[model samples]
Target: MAVEYHGFRVTVDAKADATDTQWLCRAVLEGVEAQSETAKLPCIELAIPKLKIDVLMALSMVEQTAKQAIDEWWHARQPEMA
Candidate 1:
């Protein structure tokens, strides 16, 4: 799962071992920065190290955050649709 804001992308995934109930989340943000005279675009990747958490917690966090992001993105376009 992922969310994109202002041309930047944030991705989330969960991983677990069958022997253990613990899980972790991996995430990345892809976008550009101000570095040179011109512009730099993404797939310029910035990744987060694995976060130790439960699978359900990881999934819930990702889902809630994505929904909030989507809501904000949708509201931002309301004026343009009018």
Candidate 2:
């Protein structure tokens, strides 16, 4: 699944681990504006720590975690006020 948030493209995926006991989720974030640029920022990948047995729940957790990561990444790049 994919969605656009704050000028970024967030893509999320989930799969059953090798043990098939839980669902593993990950998210990839890329700059939408930099898609055509050669010097684009490297895509950021986030592995959600929360595991779930249900696919839908896993996806939900991944999405929330990814958005939080995006927010933090954006804030870190901003200049601090004096």
- Top model by lDDT, which number? 2
Best prediction by TM-score? 2
Whole-model Cα lDDT of every candidate shown, in order: 0.49, 0.65
Per-residue lDDT tens digits for candidate 2, residues 46-80, read 34333424677778777877777767766666547
Listed in order, each prediction's TM-score against the native is 0.39, 0.69
Name the regions of candidate 2 deviating beyond 4 angstroms.
Answer: 34-53, 79-82
Model 1 misplacement above 4 A: 32-56, 60-82
Candidate 1 colliding pairs: none
Cα lDDT tens digits, model 1, 1-82, are 7765545456767776464454554554454323211322222211223355556666656645554553454456465653
Model 2 TM-score, all chains together: 0.69
Predicted structure 1, TM vs. truth: 0.39
